[model samples]
Target chain A: MRERRIIAIASGKGGTGKTTIAVNLAAVMEGPVAYVDCDVEEPNGHIFLKPAITAANSVAIPVPIVDKEKCTGCARCVTACRYNALACVKGRVLVFTELCHGCGGCMLACPEHAISECDHEIGVVETGRANDICFVQGRLKIGVAMSPPLIRAAKAASPSEGTVILDAPPGTSCPVIAAVKDSDFVVLVTEPTPFGLHDLTLAVDTVRQIGIPFGVVVNRCDIGDDRVTDYCQREEIPILIEIPDDRRIAEAYSRGCMAVESLPDVRPFFLQLDLRIRDLLSAPNGVQSAT
Target chain B: MKELVVVSGKGGTGKTSIVAAFAALTPSKVLADCDVDAADLHLVLQPEIRSRNEFRSGHEAVIRQDACIGCGACLVNCRFDAIRTVSNADLAWMFGAGIHACNDCDVCVRSCPLRSLDMINAMREASGEARKTAFVVDPISCEGCGVCVDICPVKAISFPERVSGEWFISDTRHGPMVHARLGIAADNSGKLVSLVRQQARQLAQDQNKEFILVDGPPGIGCPVIASLTGASLVLIVTEPTLSGQHDLQRVAELARHFRIPAVVGVNKWDLNPDMTDAIEAAAVTLDATPVGRIRYDRAVTAAQVAGKSVLEYSNNGVADDIRNVWAAVSALMQLDKPKANREAP
Candidate 1:
């Protein structure tokens, strides 16, 4: 089996064309590729390719359950919980399940060994395909809250194979952190605007904090501010590709078509971006691929 | 007093523009930007921070590694597996901070024969603070329960039931205006937003002002719910991109969710006419009035560059749309014609 090289496409600023690059890059890759759209809060990768979901399963996280029969009510469980999940209220112990983070603190805290673990629905992981590319997507139910667990689930469901691409969520928050955590390399898609640069700085800080190798892709190259390029230069981050601002590209996006799919001429651009990504990966001891 | 938040499910959809424009039509109003994660309203609204503070998220326990005597007592006392032979203060960093929130659990300190474990303030950063009043839960730290929220525990940081943004009472050419800047990532934005409105209401009452305007946050979350809770009226600003239509329906649905009357202002309507119409229709479905449409203006972009609001910039084809939208919103609020549309960017 070929090693699955995970490529996470992330940008702190939304609408900066992260998904645009993710879908098309997969379409242009050689061999069998698996795409994981980990932007659970708002997964739009499927919107472009409109993947017909072949399999989907609800993802759940573990929550603790106290077996009162084994209870000593020592209150150690209450004190051990960091999430404020277990509480001693007046004469009775109260467990607010929503507040639970399920770190197994309370389970070990019980001297009587009363606490057991239960499953709580956190989100759903979806498996599907777009064209010849095998795809996995995570959909966080609105108002259900939390996207990181689903992001992890989607990554876990990824098919082992050729280049794997992950479409990350906007912003350098926890979900973004989770989506890009174990990737081989990260491609930050951005535009040449002050807003984009400001957010790109945050994303750069995040990738650095997590200790990952990354490069920059400036979408809509000619529009807005030039501060993005200046920062990339100052930071010593490599600029891989610069796709110019064109109305035809926007039109294709509006019609729910991939840039490479609609404009086959631009297919070369994705190919080049992919080649550069591979070259960067093979160059160093950093970010060993999780084959 | 009513609190109103402006949010879009999608990003860069002009949520702030509509709020700034709304500030033009009202008598006296305070604004709060709750998107602490990617706050850019200051680029246009020009918030002058009166004060700032350090926001500490959690506690860090450091071990005096050389204290000797590995009695294994600290491990026994530590309910969390955070303490180990290799890592003294914590073998498991993910362990409970319950030591302080810890109900007199001296098990760690007392049980530690080596006396190496010491609990100290962990992660602290200098953050922005202001108080016209808006408590914005830090977007980076704010998470609904069940999703393990990464937070600071040094001080066991819990926000005030009411933390407000720095209050701004300024004189604009149009009328008296109010606004504020929230710290990098505070919480209880709903409460702080209500403070802005209450302050605005008080200012209006003191001055016998006829209106109280507000600039709200984006999206339909708790903050958005708070933004529309008791507002007399709302004006939703949106772009004409595909995401614009998608977000407009969601935001309008949120406004209707809280029973706040809302009006519409389509910023950069010329970017996508068909999408703009779709937004109008969506607003109608939510019973929100489609007030007016603004064309895509390079002037609006230039205005941000000059550090000024569009109203303060050249009154060209786009400014008319802003003026018209202001009129429609005021009319919906059962008011007279707006005297002037003033802005400070």
Candidate 2:
């Protein structure tokens, strides 16, 4: 059986080409591959991949629906709620569905059995196909504050037996963690500028604490200084690929086209990146070999 | 005072760069970087830290090893799966030797002559009362909800307030700035962003400044909402791409939901002029004023590399475009000034 790998491309700072990398890598790979867009807040992988929507499912979380007729306003549910999603005022319990994390603590604490779980749709998960690669994306409903649950839903809908390329949301917050956790490997995409290096350090710290094996891919390598490479070298992290600053690639991306299909020159880099990832994962000690 | 928050639903749409330019353009304003996760405005403004304060929020559960009877209560009750039980030998490798094996009982350490050095083997042969396993919390996974502390049967869990991040009040070359850095992998960024904005507002009011220029985080989530809520105006920076257009509509929708007037600017509009036009038209339908468009200029990257805003680096090309956008935004802000004051009361 071929070794199935879950590779997540993440950058702490936004717009360092996480979606670009994930789509291109999936586009170039020969075997069965799946692309999961876990950036529920934005989700740009579909723009580049142009996936055909095969199925769509609404993702909802359980929010407390209080029964006023139950006759007891003990306020125990409010006290048990840690998210401040519930409040007792004027002898009535008000439930703020948006603030609820769906932890079910309020329901358990309701002495009168007044609280019941109701599904609140936070986002939608879409499953489809973009050419030979399977596609899954989470689109958060506007005005929705929570995204981690939707990200997890998107990941759950992804194909389990294949090379899963997860394009994580920017920032080292709960959403990013939800997308990248349990992955076999992570590709930390970054530019070489000060902003890039600064956020890269945070991303490195996050993946390190998660205990995931990872490497770096420096996009627009020629524009910024050598600081990113220097930092990576000092940290003994592998530089899987260095893509120079190219206008053609940017223009291709702006037109919603895959770089591998639009620009022949960009194909080899992603192909090489795929091989490097396979080599690192197949090694006895993936972390040591990546270094 | 008026607050003008610059936000982008998609990451890397040049929110910080535009904020930096706005800070340089406006003299009597306080700057705030509400993007606590990846705060890069300070890189351009070059702020000098005047005051730094720790940002503490919520609580994390810490189990007292001696009080725990290896009952797995915490592991079973923890909804976040933050608690993990490790063998005595693995625990020794994780925390190292100097620390006490059990703070209260001290049975494991007292039986071993080498303190905790030989505590693993000693624990194995020690009385059955000694715990063979210890529960530890993963700081990242623990949501600081205190559920584990409430559920601990033996009262072994101690809930301590967590220092999630830090906020800084600094003096920039342009004006007084308020910024923050969220602790690595820490939650509660929305709270931290709100703190930065509140401090900036207070600073602006104290200094009698007329404007508070805020650089907001990407996405239309909690942190972004925290940055823009109750603000006088919001300028959404977008690019000329399908993804950019898609994200702009969502962010603009959020702004409309909050009843905040929005202005839009297209960055790198020359990359795809057709998409730029389409986005501007969409912005109009979304009730956002299309201020202006910035041409695709490599000089923007050059300015970033020089650690300066485009306006500070040179007064031409992209700088001129940004200046025009600023003028349009300022006009819109002025038109809504009376409305803002009326809404406040």
Candidate 3:
């Protein structure tokens, strides 16, 4: 059996073309492929892929429910909670569901056995398909604080047997970690500008710390100076493919069109990217697959 | 003091660049870099650290090696897959002599039939790896539910706070700036952003500054919400891309939901003029004033490379556009001053 790889397209900075790379790769790849958009806070892959929703699952976190009838408010649960999700005021345990991490610590801390968990839905994961590509995305309900759980749920929905392409959220934080963790290889998308290089370096550190083999693809490669290229060369990080600053690409992207479909000539770039990732996966060491 | 938080629902939409430009344009104001995750404003602002403090937000679980009986209770109960049984060889390789630390789920303590497993202080025990393979907490994955704490039968489990990140008060050319860095995979960025904002506001008050400009993170998550809360105005920088339009609507709606007025500016607007117009129309529909449209200029990147704001790098059309936008923003804020004061009582 051929090895099935999960490739997470991520960037430390937002709007660095992670979704662009992810959606385009999914579009160009042949055979079985799954695209999971874990950027729950602002999932935009759907706009580009236009996946039709076939199923929807609500993702929830368990928050402590105080049984008032069982009634001895010792505030033990409150003391055990680190998130300040539970507070005891005047013998009343106010359960702040939004603040809860759903760690179930409060339930275990409750000596009276009065605390039980109830599900608080934070977001939803929708599964669908765009042409031959299997698609899934997590969408956090506005004003929801927690996203890692939802991102996990969305990621879990991807088919395990296929090549899974994950579109990660921006930032070098927990949410990005959650989205990109456990991937076989990470494609760190970045721009060639100073901000891009700075954030790209951070993303590289994160992927390196997570012990994953990864490479970089510089978007708008023609626009920014060679700083990103210089840094990548200095650090011995492979520059996989560079997407030039093209106005038509941006226009097509603005209309919610994937580059593979809008710019047929660009198909080879994504194809080469796919081959590069596959080559890296098949290599004994992923770090040396840059060429 | 009034707060103007610059955010983009999408990343790389020129929020930090614009914030840096604004910092250059507006002197003698407190600046806060609330995008604790992937904070890059410091790269441009070049703030010299004045004061630094550790941010110990949450707890991770640790196990005492001498107390651990080698039971697999923690390994089984860890929902985060943070706990794992290390082979003797790997343990030998990692620590010359010491037991592994256990993450504080406390399940092993409760499930230990021999009553040998005990919870140790997460911060202290984890730091001092006494038992190389005995107890361990994967700090990145531990959600701090305290489940293991309750389940510990030997009463060995104890939760200790871990330093998640650091926040700093710094001196910049613009003035005092507040910023923070979240520990790798650390949670509670919203809290950290809140802390930085709190400090920025306090500094503004102390300094008698008129503005508290914030460089907010991309996306409408907890940190973004924290950045937007109680702000006088929100300027959303967006690009002329499809995702940009979609994200702008989402963030604009978020600002509207919070009853905080938002203004929109399209960066790299020349990338797609039609899309820019469409975004402007959408912004109007969302009640977000389309304040400015910056053409796709190489000068922006050149300015960034020069470690200078576009305004300082070039006295060009793009810089003029940024200045015009600031003018509109200041004027809009001036009109809002009375309403804010009226509501203060």
Candidate 4:
């Protein structure tokens, strides 16, 4: 049996080639692999992978639906809610579905049993296949404020026993945390510039707090200075791979083409990356630093 | 004051770079970096910190282990599954048992006929003591909803405000700038973004600046919404890619939903000119004006690496493109006319 590993490619700063690395890595992997795009707000993996849609599942969360007939306008639900999802306007209860976290606190607090739960569609989870690899992505409904639930739905649709590569959203906030957490290993892709180094440190802090083993992969390594590599060495974090600033790769990416499939020169880099990840995971100490 | 916000629905289509260039071009402006999660405009503007303030919002539950009576109230009521149970033996291993001096009497130790001291020491060393479970709150999972704090039977849980991030007021070469940094793994960035915008408005009022230029975050989510809600105008910077077009439509819809006028600028338009034309056409249908197109330029990155805006680095190529975009945006904003003249007589 092949060892199952869930790897997340994440970059705190936007436009650092996170999806580029994720799709190319999936293209180079052998056998049955799963690719999950957790960047629900702006998912780009579909543009590169061009997966054929086999199924689409609408992801919804439970929001409070008030039964006015059973009502005593006690305002308990409004007071109990921490998110300001419920309001008492002119002795009537108003539900702001967008503000609700869907925690069901309002339902639990309703003394008159007036609050009931209803499914509120926030996004859709689409499942399909791109060649031998199973592909899943979350598309958040336009104007939806929350994306973590949709991201979770996409991850849940992924095959449990396989090599799963999750392309995480940029930033170190809740959405990024939801996408990257629970992965066996994480690949932090970054450029070597000041913006990249700054955001990389925040991402490192996030993954370290989650207690996940991670390594760095610097994209466009030749474009910026060597501070990123120097920082990794000082922190004892492994530098898995460095992809040079290649115009061909950028052109391929802009045209919605996978680099591994379009550029022969890029294939070797991704293949080598796969080998390094497997070797590191199988090592005794793994890639986790002492800090 | 009239406000202009620059947003990119997709990540890294050169929103910050353009905003920095606009800051350099426009003199009577207050700048704000509303991308609190991974703020990078400060890198280009090189703001000198004038004041830094902590941003606190919401509350997370904290359990007092000493007061907890091993009740399951909080664990059962938490909807987020943020509560966790750990055996007392495990806690003792991690954090030592509160075994101080029992008044130095040693009566219990001496009274046992089986030599309880040896047994007690052995149990502590081997972590084999009888286990009593204690509850704890996982900070990440806790939505700071206060449900656990309210449901605890023994009132052992205390809800305290969370220090989500920090906001800063700073001085730059061009003007005063407002920005923030959301704490690692913290929530409520939308709130922080709003606070930063508010501060920028206040600073602009104080300094008598007529314009406020805001660099908004990527994605059409909470922080992005917060940045552009009441702004006078919004300029969406996007690239010539399928993903970029898809995200641009959503963000343009967001601006329209909020009733804010929007304009679009295609960055790296030379990478895929066909897609650029398609995106501009789509932007028009979405009621967004296509203002300008910027060719793919390495000088943008070069200028970023040198910590200078492209306009400041050189006045050719992308710099000229940015100047054209700014001119169109300002014309839409009617900034060439004095504020008093534009007002109703």
Best of the candidates, lDDT: 4
Off by over 4 Å in 1: A64-90, A93-96, A106-117, A285-291, B20-27, B58-266, B282-292, B326-345
Candidate 1 vs candidate 4: which has greater DockQ? 4
- Per-candidate Cα lDDT values, in order, are 0.63, 0.85, 0.83, 0.86
- Candidate 4 C-alpha error for residue B282, in Å: 1.9
Candidate 2 runs further than 4 Å off: A1-3, A284-286, A289-291, B69-73, B87-134, B341-345
The top-ranked prediction according to DockQ is: 3
lDDT by residue (B147-247, candidate 4, tens digit) is: 76665545678999999999999999989999999988998989999999999989988999988999999988788889988788899999998878988
Residue A236, candidate 2: how far off, in angstroms?
Answer: 1.4
What is the C-alpha lDDT profile of model 4 across A158-215, one tens digit per residue?
9978799999999999999889878888899999988899899999999998888889
Candidate 4 Cα lDDT to native: 0.86
Please tell me which model should have the higher DockQ, number 1 or number 3.
3
iRMS, candidate 4, in Å: value is: 1.2
Question: Each candidate's interface RMSD, rounded to one decimal?
Answer: 6.1, 1.4, 1.7, 1.2
TM-score (0 to 1) of chain B for each candidate: 0.61, 0.86, 0.82, 0.84
Looking at model 2, residue A286 earns an lDDT score of: 57
Clashes of each: 37, 0, 35, 0
